[model samples]
Every structure is written in C-alpha cells, then in structure tokens.
Target: MARRKIVRSPDLMLLRRALKHLLPGALLLAAAAALPRVPSLWRLVLELLPIYFSLVFVGGFLLAWQFDRSRIALTLLVLALADRALLHGGHNVHDVVALLLPVNLAAFSWLKERGLLTPRGAIKVGALLLQALGVAALARAHSPAAVSWLSHPLVTWPALAAVPLSQPALAAWLIAAGLAVARFVTRPAALESGLLWAGLTTLLALLAGKTEPLLTFYIATAGLILVVSLMETSRSMAFDDELTGLPGRRALNEELLKLGSRYAIAMVDIDHFKLFNDDHGHDVGDQLLRMVGARLLSVGGGGRAFRYGGEEFSVLFDGKTREEATPVLEKFRAELADTPFIVRGKRRPRKKPSLPLPAGSQKKVSVTVSIGVAEPDGSHGTPDRVVKAADAALYRAKRSGRNRLCT
Candidate 1:
C-alpha cells in the first residue's frame, strides 16, 4: 500500500498576507475601471499619475516608511492598468471593489500580528485609496450621465462612502454596506456572508443588463478570496505541530526572524525521556509528553510555545530581556514538577480532570522535565545558532542531574 503523504496547510495569518497583496490590486483595478463615468476621474488619474510616480520614487526614502514589499506594490500598479483594460468607463464595479478595503483591513487586524494598516500597511492602503478616489472623481467629471457613486468622495471612498445619489447605485451601495457591517460584527464566520452578498449583487447586476464590469469585478473578488483561503490552509499546517498542539519548528524559525529586539528563547526537555519510553512502553511515554506539553503551554503566557520534536519543546519571550523571562521559566519548572501522567489502562470515563472518573479507580503515572535558557541576539547570524545554544545548555542540565534548569 502507498503511504499517506502529509498535506500542509497555510494558517489564517498567511492567507491574510496573500490577500493583502491580492485585495489592493483587485480593489484598485475595480476603482480604475469605474472611472470615466465622472469626467474629473480622468484628470485626476493624469494629475495623480505624477504623485503616484513620486510615491514610487520616495516609497523607499525612509527605511521605516517602506513596506519592503516592492513586488506586491508593483503588482498593484499593474492591476491599475488591467482595470482600465477590462472594465473602464462608467461601470458598476465600484460596489464590489469598495468592499475590499474593509475586508483587507479587518482581516489584517484580526488574523495577523502584522497588518496592512501597520505603518507599511498604511502606505499600501494610502496608495490604493488615492487611486480609487482619483478614479471616482475622474468618472464623475467626465460623464454627464454618470452616477454619484462614480463621483462624490462620500460615495466613492473605498472604506465607506457618503451614500450615492442614483437609486440603483444607492441600493447596491447600501446592500454592500450592510453586509460589510455584519461581517465586521462577527468576523471569520461572518466573512463568508459578506462575500456571498457581493457575489449575489454581481449576479443581480448581470441580470439587469450591462453587466460586463460587474461580472469582471465579481469574478476577481471570488478569485482573490479563493487564493487567500488556499494559502491560509497551507500556512496553518506548516507552522503548527499536530501532536503537541504547539508551534512546529518551522514556525519558531519564522517567529524568530520577525523578532524586534531583546527576547528570550528557552529549550525544554522531558527528564530521562528515553528511559520512560523504554520502561513504561511508548503509550505511557506519549502521555507524559502530553502532560509536559500542557504545563509548558500553561506557563507560556503570551509567548509562543513550540514543539521542537520528540521530548523537546521551546518557548519565546517577546519584548523582554533574559532577566524578565527567568521568573516565568522558574514558575513553569515548579508547576510541571507537580504534573502527573496516567499510565495505560488506568483511565476513568474521560481522560482529563473535568470529566468524572470511574468511582474507586484513581491511579496515575508521571514524569518531569529540564530546561535551558538563552537570550536572542539580533546580530547573531541566524535563529538556528541561537536554538542550538539553548539545546546544548539543555544537555548540560540533563547531565548535571535531570529536572533542573541551566542557562
């Protein structure tokens, strides 16, 4: 029989990052296509072209000002062109495209530690916003029969417009707005509803006639959502440990790379771990590992706890110097020393404490762990070296005598 291959999935955070790139482009493209309905939109695009050029020029002027994501930034620029090519001139693409702003910002804020609204995030947001606003102005000034949705800032702002004058436009805008509100009230779960609303609106526009631009916008929105979902699923599987419910080694490396300054990295190992497995058999050994894993998680606080593989784990303390994490580490050591492991064949109805155990049957087994501590040095070549240092220290602790900590 062929062995089953493990499938890795992206976490919600990665999906959100990918969407960060896709949404801006898609939104700006929609806005660009919506232009031409307002005469001023053309003039603004022309006038603002120079400004956008300047932004591109000065985008890297200050290290702090830069998003450092040049590839995605350039992609947004290209998307501008695509919008004009596919859906230009007084179209009904605004409603769908406008939805991207809230979706993008909200997802970034909630799912990822980093967001599009972050300093770098704001730059992309500003760029895309400027483009959308410029288009709305151009479309209104250019076309006499053009609708208010294509003109007024209140109506055209990607975040939330003032409300359009045209009944159809106003109706569409209102519907989109309502869905957006609902999504915000309950994110993740409600996010799908907002997407559905956008999709349904596009369908309505198609049935009403002159649906080319609307259809294009709808297809693109759906595509962006799909891309983000796919990436998110992949990110999760890559970063999280399946067995211990902690971060996997790959995720630890990624987290360390993003570390700002002054942090602690600690290595934890079950004391005499191999002996437990040999004497009690693999099943009991697994139970002890899980118990230790739970204790580590309890003491991890806000820091990330990761499984570094069999019988080994790690924790990262952010924004704190080594001294700051010492108390926490000591606390964890003390708490874990008291944890117990249930031997095979000694369980009640439920495995853990909350569930009632069978009356009169209360016997459990247990084990302990040793730890090694290290402070991260940004100047150091890589996270691996730092982790190795902690690992070495961990071995020293075990040699000195199991169930003790070393730095």
Candidate 2:
C-alpha cells in the first residue's frame, strides 16, 4: 500500500501541474482571436506579432519552468515593445524610453525573487517613476511648440494630458494601453512596455502627421492608468493568504463583515500546539503549521483556507451546510492524526546544529488538529458571532479529545 501510494503521488502532482498551463493557454488563445476587429487593430497586431511570438515562447518557457505566468507574460510584452522600438530605428527620446520601461519592470521581479524588495518596494517604485518621467520628457521634446515651455506646468499640462492620445498620439497610446493590459493580466512587464509603446507610438504618429491628436492622447493615457491600477489591486489581492495576509486585524474584520449565504465556517486548531512547539522546536512548529494549512486546503477545496492567526485556521465552504461539511472535515482531522510528521529534512540546519538525533527518528514528535464547525445561524447574528460560536465548539472538541471535530 505504501509503495502504491508513493508511486501514485508523482502522477497526481503531474496532473495537477498540467492543468495550470493548459487552462491559461486556452484562455489567452481565445482572447487573442477575439480582440482584433478594425484595420488599425490589424495594423497594431501586425506590428506586435513577431515580438509577441518571441515573447510568448520565451516568456512562457521561462515562466513554466521557474516563475509565475502573469509576470513572464507581462515582461515579454515589455520586451516586445522594446524590440519594436529598436526595429523602427528610434534614436529620439521616445525611442530611448521605449527601450527602458520593460527592463525596469523586469528588474522588480529580480529584486523580489532575491527577497530584496521587502520593507517597502522603494527601489522598484523609483525605477517606475524614472521610466514615466523619461517617457514624459521624450514626448515633450518632440513638440517644438511645447519644448521651450515644457517645464511650465500650465503650458505642458494640456499636451501631457493629450500626447499619447491625440491623432498625433493615438499610436503610442494604443501600444501603451495594450502593454498596460498585458502587464496587469500577466505581471509587471506590461508596465514598461506599455509606457514605451505609448510614448513611441505618440511620437511616430505626430511625425507622420496624424490629425485629432488631443482626443486620442487623453483617452489612451487615462485608460492605461485606470486599467493598470485596477489590475495591480487585483493582483495583490489574489496572491494573498486572504486571512493573515492583510496587516494588523483589519483583514479579519473586513472578511467578517462580508459574510453571506448558507456557508459552513470551520475553525481548526492545532492539537497541543504549544507543547509540540516546545518539544520539537519552533522550526518544526512552523512546518507543522504549513502542513496543516496545506491539508486543510486540499480537503476543503481550493478557495477557502485562511490562516486565522497562530495554529488556528478558518475555512468557509460554499454550497454546503454545516452538517454536510462535518464528515469531510472529520476525515481530514483523522488524516492529520494518522500521519507522522518526521522533522528531519524539513528542519533548518542552523536551528539545531550538533544535536545528534537519529537521522530518521520518528520519536521526537507528532501533531494533530481539532476543528469546530459552524453553520450560519441567520437569527443568531453577525459573522463575528458565528466565528465565536465555532471557536467555542473548537474548545469543546479540544477538551473532549485533542484530535477530533465538534459541531
């Protein structure tokens, strides 16, 4: 049975991994096929194609292997814009900017991967600002009527407002907007590429004698800002653990306020966690926490695991009453008790050096969890009260027996 289980594990992992790639590719292909309509869109698509192909392949490959898809896709778009600018023989300020934006955005990921961007992503913000400023300057330099007075806020505001959007600005704005959408849809790369595309397109359109530059520039710039801002907000929310991800206690309060529907809220607590942490070490305790979270997520479906501080987790199940969720929760609780958490490879070397325990010792510790289940009591009150009731039930389970569930 153990051999069969070990053999089956890799196959399960492989199947789960494949779905992530297949689903996104199918969605992107559908979107790409449906988005183009006008002659100008065709022209834009044509200009973007080579770079797009190179980006999709190279970016997809790198992302599939190492990084997240959204970031890679966004980066690829930015690189594509740079390649487009270089191909068009742009040496002017707009051309230089077209080259720099994507690179800067890509740099954010590099810094982040190294764990260097924490405590505030100040460097990353600075880089983005620099790119924005460069694009603004380049756009200003191209217009002779505005060059002398570019520094004058009153004089430049109108042009700055319209450059990427006017008939003279339309091309750049389109590119910028496309890049912005890509960045938000995918990751950070879109940001730089979008700005460059917008800046360069605007300059090219102006030089080529486009009519109605003002309306074109305003709409494009404003639209990109709005889209990118929304995407950034969404991206932040999606990656969060949802329960403990927000700072302070505000996140929990916010979630409690939003509860609705006939949902089952499960409050799970690690059985004897304080003693377990003391007996093994905090390192093992941390691993136990993560393992418990993973188990809860696996059994409770993909979308509902929440770290409700310390060794406690709160899971809200949609489409199930409290009674229906009980058996499923109990089964998972039993699984946790049955599994032996051997802390060998999972421990940090520096945390317990030279303390010679058997390399494969299973005697050090074991962990289990207790869960309190609650259903929405419509007449009982708010979500907070519901949670408190569940907590009371969880305490009851812990008192009755450490590794069990109570409703």
TM-score of each: 0.44, 0.50
lDDT per residue for candidate 2 within 158-273, as digits (tens), equals: 55564432232233344445554454344323333333333333334333222222223322332232234334334435544432232223455566667676667788888888
lDDT per residue, candidate 1, 1-407, as tens digits? 65322211223333443343345334534554465356786567556554553443233222212433332332333233334432554543443334333334233323322434467656756766675676567555665444444343433445443232333444554565566445434443222332433333333333333345444443344334323333343455687665555678898888888877567788988887888789878876665665566556657545667888998999988777667776788787866566544564534342246765675564454466788877766544356676787888789998998788888
Model 2, clash count?
Answer: 15
RMSD of 2: 13.8
Report how far off residue 91 is in candidate 2 (Å): 8.0
Q: What is the TM-score of candidate 1?
A: 0.44
For model 2 the TM-score comes to 0.50
User: Each candidate's root-mean-square deviation in Å?
Assistant: 14.7, 13.8
Distance from true location, Cα of 245 in model 2, Å:
7.5
| lDDT of candidate 2 at residue 26, scale 0 to 100 | 34
Worst 10 residues of 2 by lDDT: 3-12
lDDT for every model?
0.54, 0.51
